[model samples]
Target chain A: MTQLQGAAPLGATVVAEHGPTDPRDQRPVRGRKKVGIGKVIAWIVMVIILVITIFPFYWMLRTALSSNGALYGNSTSLLPADFSWGGFERVFGLQTVDEAIAQGGSGAKLDFWRYLLNSVVVATCVTVFQVFFSAMAAYAFSRLRWRGRNAVFGLFLLSLMVPVIFTLLPNFLLVRQLGLIDTLLGIMLPSLFMAPFAIFFLRQFFLNVPHEVEEAALVDGASKVRVFFSLIVPMSAAPIATISILTYITSWNDYFWPLMVSYTDDSRVLTVALGAFRAQSPQGGPDWAGLMAATLIAALPMIVLFALFAKRIVNSIGFTGLK
Target chain B: MAITSPGVAHSAPNGRTSVDARRRRPDDTKLALLFILPAVIGLVVFYFWPLARGIWLSFTSWDLLSPSQLIGFANYQRMFADPVFWNAVQVTLWYVVLNIGIQTIVALVIAVLMQRLTQSTFVRSLILAPFLVSNVVAALVFFWILDFQLGIGNQMLEWIGLDRIGFFTSEEWAIPTIALVNVWRHMGYTALLIFAGLQAIPANLYEAARVDGASETRMFTGITLPLLRPILGLVLIISVIGSFQVFDTVSVTTGGGPVNASRVLQVYIYENAFAQFDFGYASALSVAMLAILVVVTFFQYRITRAGQTDLN
Candidate 1:
């Protein structure tokens, strides 16, 4: 899985003692030229794959910016057709119903802003409390010594194996029984306290914390809780931030559970709302431009977060994927 | 957050001995309980309880309006005979095969290329951009881009002297198309995982191989593949598990449409529980899915030896 083919040409050059002046070095130079061709081919392949991966996002933006009316006529155009903000205006309910219909939108009141607000509220609540509580539990597992701690941690690990779908139905029922259906609290409740991954991730980091520091604090009469809150939490801020970004993204993008529980606009999130928007198209067909605009908006927060924490998020993928 | 040196009043006379004994036998049971209570409560209530209740509910007949009646293995029997469930199983397996097969190969290639070519964070971030988008967003973007009437994908096909393919509308193409859409979203993240694995393989192994004039292919197969087994096993298991539960994209794009061609098991379960209110049947189906996953995971672990490492 690694390529050291370039080393062959280098080895050839190293073996040629007289460098470029020697006839033997000419052969190595030709070999080096061949390696250059291989490098060019590899670079070409990388660029193609990069384009495939990134083009759809650019396409989303282009389509979002295009006029809905001219989309079909200019289907093959790489540039936006009839350059218009009508799609976004319709999505944000900034256009009159007549103007929306003229632009090929369904003109249905989407409550896009409300869904955005709901997503923010739900994601924030889940991320903050989940990370905080999971960190506390991780502290217990990693720092404090107690009987059956491994057993409990093992139980949490096992929970990771349980598919989310298996518990999804019952969780919905539980939330409904609590009369939190169609409320932001219901969307946030199941995830608010702790997640198995969060605890597991934090515990992994906490295990690496030096015991000497905590011991020093204990000798100074600092309570275990104080050490955790003051010393451990501060030191573990990087991992905490990583898990927080992850939890926030997951919470924000969750669709099925929210779809099950939230019926009205009052509790609907951007993901579910976008689905509803697509299905709510008029007889003329879906407002493609408007839908793309809404998708872009729904995806904006994540894209922004990714931009800000791209390195952190990309680096965390290796750690999270292994789990 | 500075821990100020406490006065003598705070540090007791026995602090030194207690610290030493604590080192010998630390028992913070009471504090541990306090720290762990919230998570324990969450686990028991949200995860463990619902799991048990879901299993129990699987054996009963209920439709939300009436009290559930214990029906023993009847729900399981119905599931066995249900054609839709069977179709869903077949569809899901096909999807898993396609999704995991294509995704793993592509990701491994990309990971290898990245390892060989450049360690550019910019390139990795660009590849991972699609994954950062929510499934709904990815689905909708693809929906519009692949739209049969005006989608640029079809237009390009036409420009290339081919017929326009109904990506989401046709029965044969829906599952494959959906799988590809998801592949686009997850391949980068998967590649990065394998790349991390690649990074862990000691460079000295490659150096020694080069010294012996081992070809790149030989080095990769002999050295890299063996050392990378644990991570490959892990990536496969994670992706397979995730692939089996393909919901968000399907839900947003096709809603398991075109004669239920894209109706994977999760969609089937969601429809049964929410649309039809057949909670018992849904629960039974979920239990079946869980059992299959457990078996699959066990076999994968055995075959891959993911728990073991070839490296010393």
Candidate 2:
């Protein structure tokens, strides 16, 4: 600012008259050359902090790449001495994973494949079913005027307000009655099978949709079903996608219910599988490398997904919830 | 907006066919009903049924097996009488308070820092990493970090001049440690929310304050704090709700131990339902928890809303 051609004549009286609030207070003054050195210092400090934030992720990938031999050596190497695909190979292959499991060398050999499959299955199923139910409910509540509509919506809101555990007892019993215990469905069926938050998010999105779109379709002699299927559905894709991502992540990481339901590795999701693995802690001899490797394997999927879609997730929350 | 009258609207007599079209037609009520039915039925079967059964079971004296026998509030009476029940409540209340307080303050500070690193997208994303991990993963990760033996927490303590803290072990630090882990896992996400709220406040407001010769800290107190009440209140409420229903960390880390010193309401319910097979007792405990949360949350909402109106 001081160096600008027409900015100032370098007198206190004139400078105070124009930019007296001290343009350097807090908000960065764009196009100002005087702040260049300060900005560089700030950038360096920020980069250092950013490194601290990203180091854990680097460590996870590093441990995943390290071989069993390199791991057991316990050498304090930031970079791997000998990298191998053994852990991931073992995680993905049933036979390799099975032999390891049969021996049970380091506690219970986790069938990581089974857990991953279970997680994928449960997450996909719950996300699909939950989105369908919530969209329907939200559309109905928001658009349809029927007997006891407000009352029913009130019940939905009340249910949302309460902690979900209030209904856990009944849900457990219901699942038990249906013979779903120890099944993938059992873990996925509780909070999600009917999620109020989904309904809430979806309805808000649906309400923001225009009445004219459907009315215009109807005016053109288009059937209601055709209109909804064609227009409303396409328009609401963003909210539905948001709900799907949120629901999938939630179902992916669900713990206690799965722990209570699944008796063995065949039925357990990654969360419970990892949990049971950690429970059988190698107390006497700590296998830090293996434990870290296993944790990385279980955690990698969600971390990658989150990193890629973080902006979408945050913006999605702002979008879906605000309406 | 709508003039709904079934009588004297139209008569489908001879030559009244076209005339009927002139009268008001039925609204798109049927389509709306169709839209809402899927969610309604799902909730009814999965949520409402279970909720009713749970509430009813609170009055019965039954276990996992056999039909529930009505016992006229015996479970509630017992819950009220038991000292352990109160202990769990106290710990839970403390957990809720401490978790909300610490998380709110830290999240606010972090949000402020994040806003400062406006030019750095990596730092913003970095701050949000822990939030991306699920609650269980966060708890498990922290559990590993706080492991008494080879844990990073203890390692850090050794690196520092201080003695090792028993984090999730010794009765004294167990609950607080759980709270800290909870905060660490959640702070990034909460801070992200608060940071959004802060960013949404127009830059011109702060500039105006600055032009009025307000100091940075004063501008924060007068402008930022006043504007951030809604988001802060939300963070406070949600954190409280999350803490009240806390079961994952208690189960994974301490096993509610050093003698259930860190036991929360959910854990208490878990023990009753699973260990004792006292589903009736568990139901009663859950109902009590529901009532307490509703009352507390309602009060908090009212308080915050009232403060907002008063400030206005």
Candidate 3:
């Protein structure tokens, strides 16, 4: 039991069937600490790269804050000189941000609020359905003693490789026939409802759940559904959280389908709206400050989430991909 | 997803099947079906149904504007004969090549750099911020930066001694620009993946290499790189699949460009289905792309799996 203490945290040591019996893995391997020039050089390179990676985002926020008139000015400085809430002012589509909010507009005619609301609705609905169904399917695949399970899973895996383009016309036609165009339901139905990857990922998670626990639940008179929702759901937080974040982000940022299906601003999500805005810009092109502002706003929610859950998100990609 | 044996194989210490569950399972088949009904129905409706429709649609002449003619293989034949489709094919290949090449190199480098960090977790998350910014938003951000006059790239170039480069307008630079934008957004995800693979690896492997007094290059060539084969293969395969389906980015950034330089397969399909309403041709094109992707991905999986080791 003591041997499970130091196996490179998050790279959690494989606790075997013997229930954590390995002594060699139990001792912490304090990795070599660097010193002098090597340490300084490594740190310097790290900082520089971090700056480069983060500079685009920094520039984005700075550009968002820059005045429309001042943006055209040759400014080498990272920080905007003439900073105002002008871009925010423009997004609200009023003389001031407050005035724009008082009206129907969130900040502008097509500011953050409407699009944010659309995104929230789409993402939330997509996540809930995708996760729930994926979980149930995953449970069945992982637990059910059904015939042709391997073949079914293999087919589903093949579905993962089939790109969205292959399914586009068919889905579009289906939606059109159903008269779901320009509806939130249209965008959600094709993708968010059920993804093969979601099933695959959750199945991987479900496979890891020790069978004894579920057996215990079964012995205690729990049905499969009860065991799943009550037992597995609680213990499956890591993978569930991972999938939820993934589904939520993917849904929020979805572009191609939304662009293809929706015609009006009513059903238009952030991606499609931003896409059309780019398409219709004049020869002089899109307003840099305003566009950047809009992009920043659209990206803000996920950014905050990523910042808060960076570890899980990073590890989630690794985890989900590996699964 | 560390799935070992599944939960169904649950057995007691005495090797008897766990009791009480099956005895009480009410209408067993019905209950199982009830639990799985939503998923089964969902797959049939969303996936299987659409796939079947798409396959069937490929067999007929169903242009949105025209009468639904039952023309078998003609759409496929026309696609094969058309140079336009071939151009789209070439652009698609270019996009895939560029995405794989740039993202692989950048991801490897970033992964290596990230591995060197004393604080990898924060850096890993920081690097992955781009992944959250969806294709549309990322493209819009880049679109603004690559605008004809107001573009930051041109603006910066003008400030320097160099001439302002027409990133989007120029045929030569347009495809590369879009590919670069994709690489920028996705490289971090690949890097994170590689880092996870790296982190997952037992430190003793490196320690053993160090005991042998191996050089850093030798250590990487011997231990780190080889160990990362499975994950690297995954990243490569996914990048290839994703690159071929490059749509939202290109559509948002260049709209298939000034002279069709950036017109990838998905973009071409979109152009056919949505833009031109040639559903027959579009269906044929989609079928062709899917066939190619399936074949390519199969080989990729085989090769990658072949290279995989039982190191973990």
Candidate with the greatest TM-score versus the true structure: 1
Pairs of residues clashing in candidate 3: A91-A108, A92-A107, A92-A108, A93-A108
> Considering summed lDDT, which 10 consecutive residues are worst modelled in model 3 chain A?
A12-21
Instruction: Quote model 3's TM-score.
Output: 0.88
Q: What is the lDDT of residue B216 in candidate 3?
A: 74
lDDT of each: 0.83, 0.67, 0.72
Q: Per-residue lDDT for A1-323 in model 1, tens only?
A: 34333322211111112111212222211123255666788789889999899888888889889998788788767898889998889888899998898889987886689899999999999999999999999998877778999899889877888899998999999998999999999989988889988887777667667766777787787877888999999988988998999899988889989999899999999999999999999778888889888999998899899999887777676557734
TM-score, one value per model: 0.91, 0.83, 0.88
How would you encode candidate 2's per-residue C-alpha lDDT over B163-239 as one tens digit per residue? 88888789989999889878877776677667655654546666666677887678778767866676566556666
Q: Write the per-residue lDDT of candidate 1 for residues B1-312, one digit (tens) a residue.
A: 000001002122334545453663455888899899999999999999999999999999989999999999999999999999999999999999999999999999898888877776678788788888888888888898899999888888999999999999999999999999999999998998787777666566677787888887888899878878877887888888898989999998899989989999999999999889999999999999999898888898889877565665
Error of 2 at B156 (Å): 2.3
Weakest ten-residue segment in model 2 chain A by summed lDDT: A11-20
Report the candidate with higher lDDT, 2 versus 3: 3
Give the Cα error of residue A196 in candidate 1, in Å: 1.0
Query: lDDT rank, highest first?
Result: 1, 3, 2
DockQ (C-alpha) of model 2?
A: 0.22
Flag the better candidate by TM-score, 1 or 3. Answer: 1
Lowest summed-lDDT stretch of 10 residues in model 1 chain B?
A: B1-10
Expressed as tens digits, the lDDT of each residue in B251-280 for candidate 3 is: 877888777888888888888887777887
TM-score for candidate 2, residues paired by index: 0.83
The DockQ assigned to candidate 3 is 0.40
